[model samples]
Target: MDGRKSLGNHFEGVAARYLTSRGIRILERNVYNRGGEIDLIGQENDTLVFFEVRYRGEGSLATPAESVTFPKQRRLLKAASYYLHRHGLWNCNSRIDVVAISPGTVKKYRVQWIKNAIQAGF
Candidate 1:
């Protein structure tokens, strides 16, 4: 893979590890289709979460969460819908989540988990 993609995968790993430590069971990663892509798929309690992992290094203007704009949100919703239909998970409760990561001075990285970051059909 290229440098940017490799870095993204690394951050996704970081996000996954962080979430796993907090009791979320990761089911899959890099889930992609014609619609779009989901960085991570995991279970949190009874909720099926579709995570969009975003990472912004130091000096970046926008925070990781801010990078997920309106267009990005629409694409994520489409991808999440495809995922649910493909897995026959229509009856299951699900939500789109954002894992925002950034470099921190004290800690190596700062991680923020935003639940229900995007709603379907929005």
Candidate 2:
């Protein structure tokens, strides 16, 4: 794979491990459809979470979370809708989340988990 794609996968794996440690069970990863792509899909309690994992390496100007802009949010929502329909999970409780990762001074990476970071209907 390309360098960028490989890096993304590696970071997604990191994010998955971090979430798993906190009790979330991963259902899918790298879900792609006509709508767009979802980095991770996991179950937290009774909620089905669609995670958008963003990573900003060292010396980046924008934070990882800040990179998920309005357009990105719309694409993520569309992809999530497609995922639900494909899995016949219309009745399932779901939300879009963001896992932002950036280089850290003390730690190897700083991970931020933002629940319901992107909402539907817009």
Candidate 3:
């Protein structure tokens, strides 16, 4: 894969491990559908979560979470909606989440989990 994609995949894995450590059960990764791409899909308690993984290295202009803009949120919403519908999960409880990763001073990387970061009806 290209450099950017490779880097993204690496961070997605990082996010996966981080979430798993926190009790989120990952069901899928790198999911592509008609709407857009979902970086990770998992279950947190009874909620089905669609995760958007964002990464920004040092000196980047935007924080990893800030990079998920309005347009991106719309896409994620659509993608998540499609995912829920495709699997007969229209009534399943779900939400879009974000896992923002960046370089850290205290550790190798800083990870932030933002629950329900993207909402529907956008």
Candidate 4:
């Protein structure tokens, strides 16, 4: 794979492990639909979560979470909608989440989990 894709996969793995440690059961990864790509899908309690994993190395202009712009949020919403419809889960509890990763001053990496990060109306 190319450097960018490889780096993204690495970060996704990091996010997956982090979520698993927190008791979230990962259902899928790298899901592609007509709308866009979903980095991770997991079950946390009774909610189905769509995760967008982002990474910004040291000196990047934008933080990892800030990089998920409005347009990206729209696509994610569309993709998540399609996923729910396809799986007959339209009535279930679901939300879009973000996993932001970056270099930390003390630890090797800093991970931030933002719940309900993308609203559907966007």
Candidate 5:
């Protein structure tokens, strides 16, 4: 993988570990459909979470959260819908989240977890 992609993937792993440590059960990763992709699928308490993990190197063109444009939100919502329907969980309560990761010096990492990131559905 290229540097950026490899970094993003690594951040996803880190984010997953963080979430799991917080009592969330990971359901899937890098799930794709006609609409687009979801970085992570997890459950917290009684809620289903569709996580979008954004990783940025130094001097990023856009902030990790800002990278998720409106169109991107639509695609994410569609993918989440497909996931719910495919899993026969149409009635299941779901929410979107943003896991922003920024690499730091000295092997440190900065992470921000934003819950209810976007409104889901068509």
Candidate 6:
């Protein structure tokens, strides 16, 4: 795969592991829908989560978390809506999350989880 995709996959893995470690059950990855795609879907505290996984390679310009823009949020919201409708989960409490992964030093990686990073309007 290309570098971007590869990096994203790495972040997804990291995000998944982190979420799992935090007692969140991941339900889906790269969920595609009419609006756009939600990187991850999970359940935490009886709430449905739509996640966006972002990663920045070393020596890059922008911070990993800075990549999620307004347009991206719109797409994510659309995707989340489609997922909820398709799954018949309209009533499920949901929110968007962002998991940012940055290249770490030789010993470890840095992962940041931003919960309720965006909202979906009905």
TM-score to native of every candidate shown: 0.96, 0.96, 0.97, 0.96, 0.88, 0.89
Which window of ten consecutive residues has the lowest lDDT sum in model 3?
Answer: 113-122
Over 4 Å off, model 6: 1-3, 105-107
Tell me the tens digit of each residue's lDDT in model 6 across 1-122.
Answer: 99877867777888999999999999888776677877789999889998899887788888888988888888888888888889899987889889988877764778889999887664
Lowest summed lDDT window (length 10), candidate 6: 100-109
Encode model 5's per-residue lDDT on 1-122: one tens digit a residue.
89877876888899999899899999998888876899999999898999999877789988888888998888888888888888899888899999988876766877889999898552
18-69: candidate 2 lDDT, tens digit per residue: 9999999999999889889999999999999999999998888899999998
Candidate 1's displacement at residue 35, Å, is 1.5
List where candidate 3 sits over 4 angstroms from the true fold: none
TM-score of 6: 0.89
RMSD in angstroms between candidate 4 and the native structure over all alpha carbons? 1.3
Candidate 2's displacement at residue 90, Å, is 1.2
lDDT of 4 by residue, 26-81 (tens): 99999999988999999999999999999999889999999999999989999999
RMSD of each: 1.2, 1.3, 1.2, 1.3, 2.0, 1.7
Better of 5 and 6 by lDDT: 5
CA lDDT of each candidate?
Answer: 0.93, 0.93, 0.93, 0.95, 0.87, 0.85
List where candidate 5 sits over 4 angstroms from the true fold.
1-4, 105-107
Return the clash pairs for model 2, or none.
Answer: none
lDDT of 3: 0.93
Spell out the clash pairs found in candidate 4.
Answer: none
Please give the TM-score that candidate 3 achieves against the real structure: 0.97
- lDDT for model 6: 0.85
- Stretches > 4 Å off in candidate 4: none
